[model samples]
Target: MHIEVAKKSLQKNNQEVYNFLIDIKNFEILMPENIDKFEVLDANTFKFALSGMPEIILRLKEQHPYEKIVLGAASDKLPFTLTVNIIATSENESEVGLSFEGEFNAMMAMMIKSPITNFMETLSKNMDKIA
Candidate 1:
């Protein structure tokens, strides 16, 4: 499954947003208000549980300086990647977007499509918090 959230402009520059996202702990600020549990396991990993979702562990999979950050699920049972793309629009402003790609069977994909799409959109909307 692949899902892309709408991009949003941030008040901060691309480098600032990139720096904030590089630290896994900063993700807490971007999480929805319904988040029930959250913990930074290390510099590049975190565990979190939403109101009705199972606990998920995510680890940093790749980074491209101020351009992008990719995070992958820690377990193969639900393998997925969430990519954060940053584009500098000016000296002190930028736009950010979230894209999710997952490996799931057709039946499972149908079951998760809505919730996953909502989750990605929520995260993208929360991108402005980085400022």
Candidate 2:
């Protein structure tokens, strides 16, 4: 099975959001329970640990500060690609639209979708605070 999620977040300062993306390490502080570890391996590469799982490798396939960021992940349990696009609507406004696509067995797919959706909602809600 495959799953996808798209969310629109309230706009905020573009530079602030861009800086937030660059400071990858701060993910743990923003979403402590869901994100175990976020390491910037290089300018466009990193490794991360998700909830209840081992560290997964992720490479920033594409990134445009304050505009968009796309990440790909490969895992036995769920091999998926997540694309996050951030667009600045105004100096103090921006929106983040996330698109997820991938494959998984039916049972696992059903189990994972709910949590993933919840996670996205929570993340979007907290963007203002973090920004």
Candidate 3:
């Protein structure tokens, strides 16, 4: 399953957004308001529990400098990849997008598709407003 969330112009530079995201502390603003718990286990790993979803660990898979950030589920139980792409549009602004790539069984995909798509879209919109 592949989900394209949102793409929009961000107020900050590509490098600035990239740097802020590398630190999990800033991720709170990008998550849903009802998230039960979010903890940073390490510099590149964090675990979060959504209101009605199982807790999952997301780890930084790779960094493509100021262009992109790739994160994936640390547990094989829920295999998925979250990609953040940044393309500079001006000196202090950039076009940013969030996408999810996952492999899910037929029934599972049917269940999660809408909720996850909405979740990622919300995250992407909020991320654009970050300074």
Candidate 4:
């Protein structure tokens, strides 16, 4: 399944936004306020847990300089990929968007769809924090 959250225009340029995202430490600011726990394990990995969800470990999967960043779940139990795409609109402005793609059985997808979509949207909305 794939879900695309709302894109947001930011005052910061794509390079600025990309720089912020490349640092794992900044991910905590993009999580929902109800996040249970957040930990940056290394330069390219982080783990976070939401209220009642299992802790999720995400590792940097790929980066396209100032264009995009992709993180993949470390566990196959809930396989998913989270992508942040940055599009430069001007020298000092850009748009940011988040997309989530997951592989799950029908029953599991049905159960987690709403929460996952909400999570992605919240993350997208929080992109302004980088500005």
What is the descending lDDT order?
4, 1, 3, 2
Q: Which candidate achieves the best lDDT against the true structure?
A: 4
* TM-score of each candidate structure, all chains considered together: 0.96, 0.70, 0.94, 0.96
| Residue 71, candidate 3: C-alpha displacement in angstroms | 0.6
Error of 2 at 29 (Å): 3.1
Give candidate 1's error at residue 48 in angstroms: 0.5
Global fold similarity of model 2 (TM-score): 0.70
Model 3, span 61-112: residue lDDT tens: 9899999999999989879999999999999989888889999999999999
Comparing 1 and 2 by lDDT, which wins? 1
> Of the pair 2 and 3, which is ahead by TM-score?
3
Q: What is the C-alpha lDDT profile of model 4 across 1-131, one tens digit per residue?
A: 99898899999999999999999889999999989999999899999999989889999999999999999998887889999999999999999989999999999999988999999988888888984
**Cα deviation in Å at residue 114, candidate 4?**
0.8
Q: In lDDT terms, how accurate is model 3?
A: 0.88
In the range 1-131, model 2's lDDT, one tens digit per residue, is 33445555565666677677666554545454667777877765677777786777766666687777677774445577767677778777778766667787778778778776765566566665664
Better of 3 and 4 by TM-score: 4
Summarize candidate 1's per-residue lDDT along 72-102 as a digit string, tens digits. Answer: 9999999999999999999999999899999
* Candidate 3 to truth, TM: 0.94
Clashes of each: 0, 3, 0, 0
Instruction: Name the weakest run of 10 consecutive residues (lDDT summed) in model 3.
Output: 122-131
